[model samples]
Target: MTKGKIKVSSDNIFPIIKKFLYSDHEIFLRELVSNAIDASKKLQSLETMGKFKGEIGDLTIVVELDKDAKTLTIKDRGVGMDEQEVERYINDIALSGAEEFVSKYKDKADTANLIGHFGLGFYSSFMVADNVEIVTKSHKKSAKAVKWTCDGSPNYTLVDNDRKERGTDIILHISDESKEFLEEFRIRELLVKYCKFLPVKIQFGTNEETVKDKDGNPVKDKDDKEKKITTPNIINNTSPAWKKQPSKLKDEDYKSFYRELYPMNFEEPLFQIHLNVDFPFNLTGILYFPKLKNKIEVQKDKIQLYANQVFVTDSVEGIVPEFLTLLHGVLDSPDIPLNISRSYLQSDARVKQISGHIT
Candidate 1:
């Protein structure tokens, strides 16, 4: 049943990866969505710094639903892909795409440069869908538009697609088994749960409302100028507490931001630590000590890690000390290698260095 090259390995790699690496399946969505956020963040940074003289439009990620087609699409108005990028980014499933993206834009963590670091993030769609397609056009007008198709296997097809914009639209054809992903409410809840403070705007659907006329009366007429409003729930916060300098941010600002992060969470953060260091490696974050009642179960992805203000991972053990897992808040460190493993960190000097730095 097994095909090709007899895939040599001492340990049962497949089972090991399935069980160990994928400790959390829902993490796939987190990874994929965060990658989109990263992409959007990069574009925003480029536009802000005047490096790329382009219209700085609404930086948002779109999640479209096609019930009939059984597909879910997460589109971003950020850096798109050209032919060469498509081939280099999608076709060859490299493990360090995220690393490359980060290295290229260390300061920008400013661009989605970190998202592609671990080619593994995009593949998260497979955890919820059967097939995934990436339709993109580079920010450069001269760049060629490209499309990539994959069906949950190593084999993938790269072709040219018709695209008019300089962004990416990733469509996931939902598998028969993963229909829960199609639920709008479920998707929204997930977005709010994991991507609340992500550094990009995220749009889900549209909404209709009555607008007041000059007479201050509700106008529901079909010809009314306030027709169909693009109902977009802002999914991310571009400038979060962790991104800015500690001196610039006030105590009230931190408390306000914390409430924004956790509304239902009643108890205030026991204490807050503002982390910002650029030397040995770029890192900036704010760790919050949310009240710990009775030996918390060691929440999986508590400390959200971001590169260049873009969400990279919630699993921050690599950069965050293990003891700090009990805390909650954002940890924006551009150093923690993409999907860095605990075992690898045990031997990695950077991890040790970072651990020593954390208070």
Candidate 2:
């Protein structure tokens, strides 16, 4: 057996990819959903260019599980990649190429954009999966479908495949060590924590469950009378409360949504500010000020910022004003770069301007 030429300059990137400064292992949800959202936006751009005349149906991303098979799939009806696109985007994830892409699009790209600022989202898959496959067909009708498979190493195979649809389906061969990714409850929690307000619809489970009785309560099944029947609570909210117009919404609606977001914290929010600025990309949001104990740490569970309604992170110290860290509740914005460090923000004036608006 012969080992082929190494693509990138660094063989040491895996350590950073698997376990870096990222304190939370759940960021994989944000990365994958962001990829889906990016694909959806690309499709929208194509529609405007008269590339795809087909009606742009609902841009919803779905996660399905095969517990018995120990598999997980993320399906997106967005701008899928053709064979060449797969080669360009999937097969080669060199950090140098990422830097080049940033340079090529820098002038026109939005500073707050979420195009793998850390250049590590794709690699995050290797953190959990032993094998990952990308089945994608570009939005272009004539583009050839490509199936890219990788085994958590430098090597990958990109071959032609058949897919009548115009999107991507990422099937993860769940590793025994990472079987938790296949759990509905775990994925649901991650989605609620990270993707509650994503611009695209993310359906995790069934739409309806019959276990709940007609009285809107869980009913004990005749066969299982000894146990109270459990009903499924659909976790992801495609159309988050922040996305709606504040004028059209009632005060109670915001409060209810807040409760849905932070159920553990029962205390009422001090005040809620709905942010619906549309000039610089589609950023819409609401910021709530939950009551904080004076003795608590200044950064104790601060505002959770969302990109395109997808929950980014609660440690939004640099994105929000320094003063705002004392507050709590949702801060959904598509522009806030979730992964970028404060050192980067200091150099970028636009990011600083966005931070100024946090107060």
Candidate 3:
């Protein structure tokens, strides 16, 4: 049994995170899931670079809610860490494994979809959980599996584990006050809001799907109704319309994506503008012009902002022009500067340029 204190300059870090790090406690899910997606992307990058000889199978991230145990687990089949790596990354505060991996393979791999920036994402789990356990097995051949446990304090425990998978499983023991996260509806809502357009697949639970026959037709029961089968409920569209080439997409494709973005809004858009710029700062998104009503304020704040496909905020006042706020759809850019919480944007010249480009 290896036990040690987490390296931090301040003893009040955990408390600060729980109380003030994020304005909304629900952001804990986004941060943790984003870390999981980063792990998966890291593995894909390694495979692209020929560094990982093993098969990269099933990169879907699964978010399981164990309400009986008051626990939520985010599992990913990605680049898991060894014992020493866990000690350095988990024990040491503010050292981002994703950032380090991207830096090391920036020239050798496709790391455009990696979403982790701040190293404090893992600590956000403490905001909603009383205790957290990370069971991980490295992707390296013959690597040993290990488990690290922390109880929302500076102290932590690391021990050998029997985990057979080559990935990470983050188990969060939901706190008494934050038991709402254990609810299926709340988790599904959060997954839709924040991770609906993430680059990797995210499964929250299972949904009923109509079983199909060999001829690609729905299988019917004796009563003539379609026979249903349970399948993993993947929340996000891994490849959203905006992520694809505009030339390859038609008018209907854009409209379909708009419906995906706003299922409640039934009105079709007047027109769509596909924005893809790469020179000053990387940006790709689609802006929709909806029919304006008497009140423009109601239409304002419909433009959603995303950083590397992770939804940041819908209030894109500074990033987009005031008039453009009436527009609907998404704006994703890895170059956009964001605060530690990723809830707000930091002022930058690129931001001003993006606003002007939108105008």
Candidate 4:
């Protein structure tokens, strides 16, 4: 193994990233998984353009929790990086491989599918992990696997690994303060909240799904009527309603998606509006008008904001008019800028144009 210091502008960078950079440490999960999704999408684009002459096998992102070991692993079947690429991308701290990939293939429609335009999302893992290890093997033929290890400091170790997969596995040593992330239930909730609509499939550890009868009731065995068969649960919706063409969706379809978005709300939406625009900016979503029990029933955070299908935040007041916040729905656009917290949506010229269109 070779040891080197992570190139950074300041020595206090890790502290800042762990404490002040993000509003909540839980954001680390979204950022890291989003990075994995972006990498997977890049490989898919390459395959589509005939650049990668390899099988595009299962691209499901897996989140594995080892409570006894106090470790959490996020694995992806994506475009893994070689040692040199890892040194340049992870160690350099300022360069975004996604940005360069987009610049290189800007003409292709799939290039816009990436979510980590800002280079710093990967470092968010440091907020929750005392140490992080990356095991990766690039997709190029004859490429050898490499492992990169770093504590929450400037020091990092890089060495050859025997991993025989064309992807990456991020193993995080969960910190005591961030032990909540080590729970399978907590991790699953985070995935459902932030990544249900992601283009790539995401699977948390196996869950049992009770088998139902033909009449939509629990199935029973001959000996015991209450007994039912259960199967493994797959957590995410690979293709959500918003990603589908509006013409192809019916009212029931939109309503079904609304339930998927806000499962707790038992009431059906009063009306719905599907927004799809592509000229000045890329935006697509479904806004629901829920029946209000009272004038104050209108909530501020009912609307969720997403960028390239990864949930950013529900607090989008700066990007949209105040009255618009009264409506409950989802808004997805690849053009908007997101800050560190990924909570406060950044307002810019393009975002203003988008807000105006929504208004």
Best by TM-score: 3
Task: Kindly list the per-residue Cα lDDT of model 2 for residues 1-359, writing each as its tens digit.
Answer: 89898654435656666667355566666777777777776666557656569878978788888899777788899878887767766655543223444465556544234344454566667767888899988877688888889887677888888788889998888888888888988988787777766656777776544466678766666786533434344456667687788988998998998888777878889888887776654556677877767675676465765554555556665667666676666665545544442111232555676666655
Clashes, model 1? 11
Worst 10 residues of 3 by lDDT: 6-15
lDDT-based ranking = 3, 4, 1, 2
TM-score, structure 2 vs. true: 0.75
Off by over 4 Å in 2: 1-10, 19-23, 94-119, 210-234, 265-267, 276-284, 290-299, 319-326, 333-356
Please say which candidate is ahead in lDDT: 3 or 4.
3
The local distance difference test score of model 4 is 0.86
Using all chains and alpha carbons, the TM-scores for the candidates as numbered come to 0.73, 0.75, 0.94, 0.90
* lDDT agreement of model 3 with the native: 0.90
Q: Best-fitting candidate, measured by lDDT?
A: 3
Error of 3 at 270 (Å): 1.0
Residue 51 lDDT in candidate 3? 86
lDDT of 4 by residue, 1-359 (tens): 99999765556787887778878888888988998998899999999888899999889888889999999998999999998899999998758899999999888647888877668878889999999999999998888899999998889999999999899999999999999998878998898888888888887866555567788887667876666444435677878888889999999998899888888989999998899999888999888988877555557888888888988888888776887777989899988877756667777788889889998
Pick the winner on lDDT between candidates 2 and 4: 4
What would the per-residue lDDT of candidate 3 be over residues 194-222, giving only the tens digit for each residue? 99989899998898998898899999999
Provide the lDDT at 10 for model 4. 52
